[model samples]
Target: MASPTPYRDENRRRLRSALVAAARDLTVAHGWPGVTMAAVAKLAGVSRQTVYNEFTDKAGLAEALARHEIEHFVDAVSTRLHEHGGDARAAAHAAVLHTLAEAARNPLIKAVLTSARGGADELLPYLTTRSELVLAAASAAIHDWAAARLTDPDPDRLALAAESVVRLTVSHIVQPSAPAERTATALAEVFTRLLG
Candidate 1:
């Protein structure tokens, strides 16, 4: 069946965004385990039933939050990649530099990495070992972009390179280091060469 009016869709999006925003804030301040549907409902000014109606359950909300975070990073990475024009090296360098900085400070990421500090951080696994959502999304996006930019298309090679970039970069996010800039620069060099 056809959808409803644009207004309805917009309202739906607005409510969903608000709920996610509320959940994120609560999670960051109180930890994932500390957050509940009731708290999200109160913060978002919606009823508890409304939160469940939109998210199904706590796990669903966490998954949505993870997807939102990954998508944001994917968009930023795409923009950074394109900003370098046609220079693969320059694009990779810029993308790497931008990505590492975001990863370090991103609250969603902090929520996961700082699990010991607070909360069960159930969402962390969805980003890391439990699911391949981040890796798959990132690799596919990078592969598509790199394929279009390449003079000679090589599917296997391009896939491997993109996967490497996503996996290695995400690994650093999971464990981190004293300085991410150095890692970003080195990885950018490798990815640049792979694409070049």
Candidate 2:
């Protein structure tokens, strides 16, 4: 058989994105337990078989949703970093503040972080226990940003700093103590000290 054309690939990507968006909406509205393959199919204007074909199973769909959201968060953080224009402390502050504020307001994130109906949330593991994607993507973004923007950076130190900041940010996102601005300020100080 011939390989798939660019057009076919683009169409598949669009369909997959639509399905993921539908799942996200359902999850935000009704939590993970309320989301069903049929519901996702209905929301996306596709058939149940199409949803199954696209995702293979519920676990696959959950993974896709988590990856998409993590990428989105990382992209936003990267943008904030770039906006600060080489001021590592400022970038860290802005990125962490934005992430914390956004997470607080995001219904999907709230669903993932909180219990669904006073029971364990199946999707929570995607953000917590099985969060390699989150850590890797966020750390890579910070590492790349620091390497480009900071002068004469030590690669090993830079990598460690990036991973440290990402882990701290994730922990804050999971269980915030103070206000976003306060937590962001403290984290920025930590990041600056780590960079030194």
Candidate 3:
């Protein structure tokens, strides 16, 4: 077996990061319809060939960008959870509230919502497909947190619980009638009851 080459891995990471950054910037600045392979490559400071080498087409680039965004969002939530410390339930609530608050203010998410409502087919793929991916990532994070804190580690139950938490959080983001902190507190109360 050959050893993994660090240099090649680094280059791949850099290229992928560049591509994702370019796609996001282009989509934000020019809207989803205006983002093209050529434009993304140009913004990324790489050749069109390089862009193709990394992503098959604009859709592929969008998927990659979506995954990157989801991962970043998850990382941010995880950081909030850690910052809360000790109280798992409170941490989970704080994480959800903080995440939704940030998402409410995020320009990229706003663009996606607008593009989807505007009936732009190009943007729809990113909105629908990437949404599922984000949901899955969120569920996984919640499942891990639950397993660590709860007495039972039933995978199926954990999955369901995680999905519920994500669904509720998403609902708050979609229609925030109350303050984010209050919404998060409500979610945490529900989650704690579920565990109990």
Candidate 4:
């Protein structure tokens, strides 16, 4: 006999994903300051209580949304790294370029950066100042990729390189000084040098 536990868990997961998607859409359209729990619930076609159940407050929802978005970004980085195999510069260039290109075109990211210009970016901390989530996730992904591909790489140096690349990449995302291709090419040079 089926206990239905798996089905129940899947249903909960879908509901949570829908709620987050609603929050993302609202944020992209109106920025984080305009997003309300009631609005998210309405957009997701769920009760306000359901939104609160999944996320205790606005901060919780913001954290969840940031984490979800970072997951997508990191997955893209990982894919680019894998696609380039063991060539450190090529991998970094490809990964960073993909990220920069995505940020440039992604409406939600555009909204976040645009909101920051108006001094209303509630989610900027997740990507910068309060960046434990972003740094840890991105740095770990980079370190793991390097460990798997680089031969006899020093652990400490590798870790530092990973964090440095991530910080630099995030800085570029926040404020770009050059085009994606040029910036990625420069960062790739630095990445290889740091790895050595």
Candidate 5:
């Protein structure tokens, strides 16, 4: 067996990033149902074969995109929580509201959610399952924050709270009877109460 070359690994990473960015852009510009592998390949300036090599199919590509988005979201939340300092509930609330607001405005998320019916039903399942992974990631971040800030952290309880917060926010995203600001504020209140 040969060891992987750093140069080759770097190139692969670049290509994968290109594919993910292209997929996201295309999905946002066109609806999720309209985004095709060929379009992504063209947008990424990579060969169709390269796209396929990196991601087996559209579903695989979408999953990669979702994973990337989730990781980015978690990082952002972690940063915000760190910056807030000494207030776990406030940090959690701000993180939840910020994430929900982003999700509400994200074109890719909107496209997937809106096109969940008909042939595009797969989009909803993909997004919902990916959301579970996201929630797990967020839960880990919350656990770390709680451990650092709280007098005595309960990892399992914090994880459960994170999951509940994410699910509630997602519900609001799926159907918003209230305004975005109000919904976010309400969610933040609930999160603060839960964390307390």
Candidate 6:
């Protein structure tokens, strides 16, 4: 079998990106229920068939959008971790602060939270209930940071720290009881204990 041509791969990537972008914008504007495959195709300036070709189905499309956004968040977290170099506490503090602040500002996250105010909740499962992807991705990012700074970091300890940090920060994003700085500081203290 022949390998996919470079032009074919590029076109596929571009089309998938366009579809995901369109779906994300529509989802932000009007809950997931409001976004239809037809609407996504129209917004993407592509045929419905093309959208299906790229994503297979609605579930696939939703997965793609979630992955895109989650990875974007991971990138931000990675950057914040790197900003603190070898200071595990500072890295934890910075990453938590940055992530929570961004979650408050991100349109898709806002959309999901806001949709709870009305009748149906169509878009939150990907983030809240069915959140394995989000948790796993976040845990991986946190583990990477911890592993880089901790002395021969134990896998179990790294996993524990990662899950603790992600779950704590996600709780804050879902419902902020205190300011992020305080939360970050507190979380950093925990990290210092775990990694110290």
**Higher-lDDT candidate among 1 and 6?**
6
Each candidate's number of clashing pairs is: 0, 0, 0, 0, 0, 0
Q: Could you tell me the TM-score of candidate 3?
A: 0.84
Q: Weakest 10 consecutive residues, lDDT, candidate 5?
A: 121-130
Q: Could you tell me how far off, in angstroms, the CA of residue 88 lies in candidate 6 after the best superposition?
A: 1.3
lDDT of each: 0.80, 0.88, 0.75, 0.90, 0.76, 0.84
All candidates' TM-scores? 0.89, 0.95, 0.84, 0.95, 0.88, 0.91
Best by TM-score: 2
Query: lDDT, candidate 6, residue 56?
Result: 88
Instruction: Candidate 4: list runs displaced more than 4 Å.
Output: 1-4
Task: Tell me how far the alpha carbon of residue 38 in candidate 2 is from the true structure, in angstroms, after superposition.
Answer: 0.9
Write candidate 2's Cα lDDT for 31-128 as tens digits. Answer: 88888999999999999999999999999999999999999999999999999988999999999999999999999998876654358578877666
> What's the CA error at residue 108 for candidate 4, in Å?
0.7
Better of 2 and 6 by lDDT: 2
Candidate 2's TM-score reads 0.95
> Runs in model 3 with CA error above 4 Å?
1-4, 85-88, 121-130, 153-156, 175-177
At residue 132, candidate 1 shows an lDDT of 85
Q: Is candidate 4 or candidate 5 better by TM-score?
A: 4
Off by over 4 Å in 6: none
Worst 10 residues of 3 by lDDT: 121-130
Judged by whole-model lDDT over C-alpha atoms, candidate 5 comes out at: 0.76
Off by over 4 Å in 1: 116-119
lDDT per residue (tens digit) for residues 1-196 in model 6:
9999999999888888889999999989988778889999999998898888888888889889989998999899998998888788889899999998899889998887787567545656767787788889988877776667656877777777777777778778878889989999998888767654
Model 3 RMSD in angstroms: 2.7
Superposed Cα RMSD, model 1: 2.1
Error of 6 at 130 (Å): 2.1
Instruction: List model 1 lDDT by residue over 82-196, tens digit each.
Output: 7776666777767777888898888867876686345475887866676588887777667656766657757776777777777778777777664777887888778876655
**lDDT for each residue of candidate 4 in 86-155, tens digit (9 for 90 to 100):** 9999999999999999989988888888888899878988888988888998887887787788788888
